[model samples]
Target chain A: MATVVAVIASTHHPFYYRASTATGEDRPPFADEWVRKILTFRETLTRADPDVLVMVGSDHFHQLWLDNMPQFLIGKAPFYDANWYNEEREFGLPRMLLRGQEDLSGHLLREGLDAGFDLAFSNELRIDHSITCPIITLRPEADLPIVPIYTNIFAPPLPQPKRFVQLGRTIRELVESWPSDLRVAIVGTGHLSLELGGPRQFGPHGPDPEFDRRAVEWIANGDLDGCLAEVTLDSLHAPGNATHGFMDFMLMMGVAGAGARADHVDTLDLFHTMEAYFTWYPNGAPTA
Target chain B: MSRYLLNKFLYTVDRDAELVERYRDDPRGTVAWWEAERANAVLNCHTGEASTWLRFTDAEREALANHDHVALFSLGAHPFLTLTLFIAMFERDHAEPLGFQKQYAVRLAHFDLPYPDIAT
Candidate 1:
């Protein structure tokens, strides 16, 4: 039987990848800083190596649509790989690190559905950066196998803040019920406060400490709804700032069963973009 | 490494860029521009003072270039940013310039033009 060893929620800003890829004239001067934060987070994740990573994040258009999009989609490939192909038609992946744990993916999908979520399963789907960038960052060599769980935060008619919590609870049940002894880590990626492509975007820069603090406070206090409500597109000052990335937290909280203790790593208000990170453990015990 | 300016590129007509044009229209070039810049696309319609940034992986760029309508709903940006980014990517002979803003107190933020894809 597999038990989740850890749950992590992080902020996502693809700009980090762009910064890494930029050249002299096109690159920003702060590329080093961005790269540093990314590297630091990667080191943290690597230090806490678990058997399986249940990646919970927003699915951007690669799967799901107004016509066919489901509220939740679970990746069930046996040997899934991350990394989008670059110009040379070569995958810019650090390595083909993440293998697919179809068994866990299938188990979680069923438990999620039984828990009242409209969960969808995909055997042929490929994992994207929402799952990729962070995975590569954490398991730099791409050795860890993954079971990706996507939320419909990108499209409207998304799961309610309350519903997402419920989904998390169901996930906990699924993890606890696994037949084989497995180690798991859940990761959530999105944003904390930085909004994308709206008036709020150009208005401010860096993680809104006030906003980020409020969110962290809510989570530290187990105010799940408060945390969820704080990260939505409408409530967030900027549209893109919807803490779609933070959904991973809710999932982790669910797995932790409302009593897990969390350790805050770094709260960065990078470049007007909010990227806060935290790690949580079940039963307040250290992960093996 | 070969770099392609989005505005100067051409793409297959039936791809995502053309499909995107069905929803948004602008004075810039056509869908090919966006298709070319799909991996790192930016949108600059409002003014020099403000713009939205978008970054897509090659597959994401291809899905958009191929005009996969479903891609629109799953991405992070709102519809306007998504549409504008798509439009600019397809527009011919159009490219947004690069510049920096004091995004954070200690760091300077960089963005690509037409709407530069903000990196770092």
Candidate 2:
């Protein structure tokens, strides 16, 4: 059986690549601190030393559209072309190509369907920053093969928060059940009190810092019951219109298992949103 | 209440560099042309198989034509789409980083929670 190496979740801020790479007068003052925090966060994953990654993220209206949208979709291909033209125009993210683990993709889709997710499969997917931002931050080498799972947090009438948790639990179960000896890490990214394209956007801090405060504690402590008790489809809008992305965090918490505290947790407060990072080792923390 | 068509306009135009420039330079003209030529065209389907009933409401059309992002938000168009396309069109005009974004927020400051329903 496959070993679940690490269960991780964090905010996928699109600006990190540009901010960290900027030099001279163009660089933002927050860039250095942000990079410092991210490097430490990066080490948490480095110690796990997983051979494959199951990447969980939502497409920001890049590929999936309302004409025919899926609540949960997984990419099953040999390769994925990532980043869109608008992302380049706005966030200065470089284009990237990632190798796919087709064997794992097939296993997840088959097992995920039997587990009742009605999972959508994309043979050809052009992933956006939700998946790429973490790759840029966590795995700059981008060497390990990945299975990209995209959820519909961006579009309306989304799946409920609890459903995300359920899916995450199922993913953890299936990964462990896989008939392989390879070590796999589950990595997902979400948001903390975000308000995109709204009245509260571009603020000095996340639209609702109090919500962010409570949210970090919930994830670090793995308080799934506390989070689900407070978070609902309608209730998410109060923090920020886009705070629904936090469901991905709930999904990660589910992967980490209920009441299982994180091995590492860190946060950086950015202008529009608060960046968060968390990692859990199911078996035990790597000694190295 | 064709919020889907409103989003379609933003999505299709935002992805295409040519359309972004055209929409920025000539909003009214670009909106009119898009309605006639591209509104019914399914993104991944054949042009001949285009849906005939995907046209935007008069208010939606006006919002896009005038580049009125605040109106778009109130009309149930996805705020992310409205914001991204608008940023592409106008962010270059600002001198400081995030200047255009902050200004964008101020434009819609009148809105409160339970903002418009964005369900397609």
Candidate 3:
């Protein structure tokens, strides 16, 4: 059976990459501190030596649109290309040949389907910033294989938060059943509060640190039910429609298993958005 | 108002490169072909060729053309598509002509939105 080694959840806003080169006036004071914390998180992943990294993030109309939005989609390819944009280039993001684990991806698709989830499967999906920003910041070396799971967080009628939690449980079951002696790491990347293009798009609205604190506290204590109870569409959407990134966070919590507890937790509020980093071991211990 | 027309317009343009090229080639024709009444009005307002039959206020027309993101948002344009359209129309070449963050910062300022020192 595959051994679940580590689970990490962190924020992946594009600005995390852009802040370094920005002028002193444009750079936030917390930017350097955030980078240091991110590097530390990366070192933890490297120490875990996960063979396959399952990345859960949402698209931003870059790959999927309303015409063909799927509730959940998994990438099934041996190699995937990161969608290159001028903004990413300006940030000096290097061209990366993202590696994929086809065998594990196929198994996940089969398991997900049999378990009553109609997950969309794609072999040629291009990834957006949600996945890239995390990888670039946390794993720039690109040493391990990754499987991209695209959840429909941006589109309306999103799958219930509980469903994502259940999906994570299902993923855990599949990993446990795998015959290979593999180390797996799941990375959930997104933001805490972000409102884009709405009435508050140009206002003084920003990240709600109190909300983020409560949500993270629940996750750290293994209160999946509590996390879901508080972090609802109404609560997340209260900040901004773009705050749907919480869906990915819920998935990571679910994959950590119901009883799994956080051994380490770190967070930063970048004024407009909040970032949270967590490391979990299966038995609620510092080491699995 | 049902944002169906606006959603459809943005969805199609973002997903279909051919249609985006078509839109660039003939904005009015593309709008007419889409046959979405409100999308047509929105695009037409931007092109300075308002439909004779469509009735839109001068403020609405200016909002559409100037890529006033908040106005588009109020009209129920998807936030992702709103940013996509802004990039496609104004920042296509990635030239930070209006300054890197200013493009979005200025628009956010218009609506008294918080301007974060970050890129989209």
Candidate 4:
């Protein structure tokens, strides 16, 4: 059976990457420090040496839009490449010529359909900061083969917290069913609370600590039902629209399986957003 | 009317290099084509654009005509595409592209809504 050796989930905002090198003295102290932390965590993930990394992230109107939006889509392209440029310049994120696992992707497509998910498939998808920020920060070398899954959090009629949990479970089952000695790692990227383009746009709006605290606690304790119950659309939206990143966290919990305890949990309060890092070892906690 | 026409217009320019080129070369022709293809009578009534597309009232139309980044966002354009629209408009002319982003952030700041630091 294919073994999921490790799981890592954290918040990824473009600011984390951009602000790291930004010159402004007004920039928060944690901005550069957070980048360093992610780089360090990447080394830990590299030591795990998983054959494939399954990335779950949301699109930021880069790849899909109102014209052809899909609730859940997976990239099956032979290679994934992106050049995310704001008006100024390319974010200088590394271009990934990462390989896609066709056999595994095909299996997932079939499984999702059988499992009653009208999951969309994209063979020519270009990813944005959602996938790139984490990959560039964690694996700047871009050596790992990746299977990219996108959830529609930008547009309305988003998938519920429970649906994300179900999808996660489905992914876990599919990975386990694969007949190989392949080691897989799951990485979920997004934030705890962020409101963008709304009334709370500037100074006063902040990350919902209460919500972040409860959700992280649930994940660290392997409380699947608790996570689903607590991370509802209303609860997430209470902090801000961008708090949908919490869905990414729930999805990772599903992959870790019910009662899959985290060996390590680190939380960072970035003022406007909360970031959580979770590491789980499936076989058993490695002895120090 | 829904903002479907505005969304489609912006997305067309975003994905189609040829359209963006056409828009850059002949703004009037591009707007004419967009109006014919996507904008309906009701949308025209709301936007207050004439057949020649000379006059526009709605923020979406005004922003499109003038390449007004702040106006487009204030009119409730998608935030991602709002950035794209800014680039499409001023990336060539502006010495510092971040100026347009700052303008967008300023416009957003006027409202009570929460804004992304990317614009600031």
Estimate the Cα RMSD of every predicted model relative to the unseen true structure.
11.2, 0.8, 6.9, 6.4
True contacts kept of each: 0.02, 0.96, 0.22, 0.04
lDDT of 1 by residue, A136-234 (tens): 556656667788888776555566656677777777678878897777777777665554433234344544557667766665556665566555534
lDDT of each: 0.55, 0.94, 0.69, 0.69
Model 3 per-residue lDDT tens digits across residues A1-288: 888888888778676776755567777677788778888777777777778888888877666755467889999998988855534533445456798998889989998899898999998877877788878777888778888999988877788888888988888788778777988888887666666654444333354556667777777777887887777665667666577778778888888877567877887656566677888866333342
Q: TM-score winner among the candidates?
A: 2
Q: Of 1 and 2, which scores higher on lDDT?
A: 2
DockQ order of candidates, best first?
2, 3, 4, 1
The parts of candidate 4 lying over 4 Å away from their true place are: A19-32, A85-90, A202-207, A286-288, B12-59, B63-76, B83-120
Tens-digit lDDT string for candidate 2 (A108-185): 999999999999999999999999999999999999999999999988889999999999999999999999999999
Q: For all candidates, what are the clash counts?
A: 41, 0, 6, 10
Top candidate on lDDT is 2
lDDT of 4 by residue, B1-89 (tens): 23555665776576566777777777666777777654443321455543333233466566677765556556656655656654565
lDDT of 4 by residue, A1-288 (tens): 888877878777666656676667745567777866776677667767788888889887666766567999988877887644431243445445677776677778888788888899999877777777778767777787788999977676678988888898898888788777889888887677665544343323254667777877888888997777666776676776567777888888888878888877877666456777888888765443
| Chain B TM (all candidates) | 0.26, 0.96, 0.53, 0.61
Residue A177 C-alpha lDDT in model 3? 82
Docking class of 4: incorrect
DockQ of 2: 0.92
DockQ of each: 0.06, 0.92, 0.19, 0.13
